[model samples]
Target: MKNWAVISTWSMSYDGLLKASSMLQNGESAGDAVENLIKKVESYPLYKSVGYGGLPNEDGVVQMDAAFMNGDTLAQGSVAAIENVKHAVSVARKLSLNKTNSFLVGEGATKFAMQNGFEMTNMLTERAKTIWQNKVKEQFKTGLHPYDGHDTVGAVTLDQAESMSAATSTSGLFMKKDGRIGDSPLSGSGFYADSHIGAATATGLGEDIMKGCLSYEIVRRMAKGQSPQDACDTALYPFCEDLKQRYGQVGEISLIALNRKGEWGVATNVEFPFCVANEKQKAQILMANPGKNQKTQIEPISQSWLDDYQKQINAPVE
Candidate 1:
């Protein structure tokens, strides 16, 4: 059996990772596996940071961003602030085949999806709308900042043939500005892949993530002979410290990587949970946090943590 593997950000991506792992095991293309992984997250109603049930902007509109990259050809496609698309990642995958105009934004992206016969839906569910309504009330009464939650579903896949791909999708920060877009749809920052090297993806505060271009940096480090774990740590930790000094305060930043050799690694400043699966290991969710001396400490996720997450996501809106 040829080597195959997949790694994705967040516990929300575990189910998608499982499906993608099966696809990879069946000798599917990396592009297909990565796209399918992201689409699953986009369609899950309980994941508030992505796709159909994503929370809305300050104006109560659920705008989404997504991107797809093909490592062999270094081709990329992206959409930003798009509305009413059932699977934004699918739209991005379709655009990756185009040579020009591959990145679209706002109404243009939405129109392209509609014209291309992609499934169209409101994107916002009643639950999300209710959450947005309550957020609006709270922000109005307390004058608090509404910028919270930008957990993008990012993934990297390596197929049996050694090909690789990277993709990302997110509804962006809840109660964000009407036209705001995050690193989720931006290459280098949100995702990067290369068949000769490796693949990487990032999730966190898009603003800071974009500044570091952590995904591409990790791949570059891997190309220079660093292992996946070292590449992730070397690329992420120093940047966090530098950003704190230069930009004042840093935000939540997390990254996941998979080398062509089927090795995987992750780095994060926050308590991030991610999913991974390869030929030798079953799909599992793991926790990652910053460690001493600029290293990352990773551990198996506890059953209690999983149970609590399930309850939190399924809890009723008040």
Candidate 2:
């Protein structure tokens, strides 16, 4: 019998993985398992970078993005900059299962969600609103808002039938420019799954991951016979290399992968906490290293940068 397993991008994803594990145990489809897992994360209020309590845009509107891919068919769907919907991953799954539409954005996405019977509720919570208000008052001067540390959430599943699926969801950056769609809803950048090869998903700075098509690169490497761990390491090397060349340090960049044989791995430029679970293993948080002897070059937001921004935020109103 093929082993069943699930892995996700962050520690918070442990909850989702637990849900996925239950579904897998009950014989759910791999696609369904992953979609349900991401949907759970989207509804979590504490993880402000995802669905319900996600950070707001420059206009204080919460816009979320999500994508889902089925490895067996190489089919996928995505929604971007969607507003008021609580489970963007479900909408993305609907699109992926749709024969005609592979992607929808902005008003179109919201309209589709409404048409599909998804309740249109204000996704921004009181806590998120208060934070947004403070951010606007400070003109985002600190660049150190409460939501800055939360990254996109993602999941990859390998089921007993050997099918694979990957899903990703996020609210994008905190106080981002209006209409800014990140890598989460974009194919290859946020998530990729291929039954013939494996599956891969990414989390961290969306712009850099999108430019590199990081998740796709990882799966492609696996297709070339690289192990799950090697594929993750190989895909992350250039991202770290580019950052080192430009800023002499890397920022956060993380990936999780599952090979065709059900072996899984994770790699990150910085210390990224993630989780893994399976039929035989319980979900547990683990730190993903860049690779063996791979020197970490991740530079934290500098104290000077934070200090300057703090001063600007504290400046007396004229």
**Model 1 lDDT at residue 233:** 97
Instruction: Count clashing residue pairs in model 1.
Output: 0
| Cα-based RMSD of candidate 2 | 6.3
Off by over 4 Å in 1: none
lDDT, candidate 2, equals 0.82
Q: What is the per-residue lDDT of model 1 for residues 68-179, given as tens digits with 9 covering 90 to 100?
A: 9999999999999999999999999999999999999999999999999999999889999999989888888999975888899999999999999999999999999999
Error of 2 at 237 (Å): 2.2
For model 1, which pairs clash? none
lDDT scores in order:
0.95, 0.82
Which ten-residue region of model 2 has the weakest summed lDDT?
294-303
lDDT of 1 at 238: 92
Q: For residues 125-220, could you state the per-residue lDDT of candidate 2 as single tens digits?
A: 887888788888776586554435338999999888889999999998897878898788888988999988899998888877877898999899
